[model samples]
Target: MPSALLIIDMQVGLFHGPDKPHDGERVLGNIRRLIQQARERNVPIHAVRHTGPDGSPIAAGSPFWQLLPELELDGDIDILFNKTRPNAFHGTSLAQHLRSGGVDELLIVGMKTQYCIDSTCRAAADLGLKPLLVADAHTCMDTPVLAASAIIEHHNATLNGAFARIINTADIQF
Candidate 1:
């Protein structure tokens, strides 16, 4: 019943600049909080970065593709990998890493609730790795159809029970 923390795309490009992700400050704080708690408990932490095509904000080899400095990930992550798709497990070694590490439960938190968060939670479920999504730790900007908060709420409601067990940062234990 060992658990690991999966931090996806908490990169500088997404968090930096004037145009911020929805609830950026609080989300960042929550992520940082999780990392610290995980470290204290000696829980293995894995982080994934998304690499987009050239000229995109998160293009490979770009500064934006780098992890945020505030994360202090020097030893925060036990495994670090990259992905080109929304799902972190797609075309990546993430699943294998988790399997080999004996990680049965994954506490997921990161950017773009509708994209990476949703995709990874489902993939994790399909893989038989228990995915516990931190409800308030994942975030995204507002879309044309809905507000960011609404999107987070929607995903929380939808992903609960079936795809992942939705937990808040305060309630999470590694």
Candidate 2:
């Protein structure tokens, strides 16, 4: 199946603030490697950035709203999608963009495993787009109820086969 890499909400703000995702550096490295591989294979790469209301960490126009510096923001090959909702396809041109490019599957990676990543995967499946979640390339901060690692594990286990197939970044093949 034709696939595009969908990196969601990998913004600097997620790394800042008092609460940050666990193993952020490692996750970033994994995502970077995946991006390089995707580029080498000429697979389309799309980045979805979350935009929050005013005063939020990811509010539009704020420094934190920008993508992390590690990402290669090449306009020629990489596409950017700004989203106000957790589901990147909600009110966004993501589905149309994918359809127009003949992309049938999405290799997903990025932040907030329990939120945007989870939402987007389920939404993708509903939209008839196969989603492959890169297990090691996504992260989330510890919540009051659960540890970050547990959240990641739980999502990977629950989402697999239902919404997406959870795979490691190193196992990804274009």
Instruction: Give the clashing residue pairs of candidate 1, or none.
Output: none
**lDDT (C-alpha, whole model) for all candidates:** 0.91, 0.91
lDDT of 2 by residue, 1-174 (tens): 899999999998886657878999899999899889888999999998899999987899799999888887676769987999899999999999999999998999998899999999999999999999999999999988999999999999999998998899878889
Q: What TM-score, over all chains together, does every model reach?
A: 0.95, 0.96
RMSD of each: 1.4, 1.1
The sequence of per-residue lDDT tens digits that candidate 1 reaches over residues 9-97 is 99988878555799988998999999999999998888889899999988987998998888888743467788999999999988888
Best by TM-score: 2
Off by over 4 Å in 2: none
Error of 1 at 110 (Å): 0.7
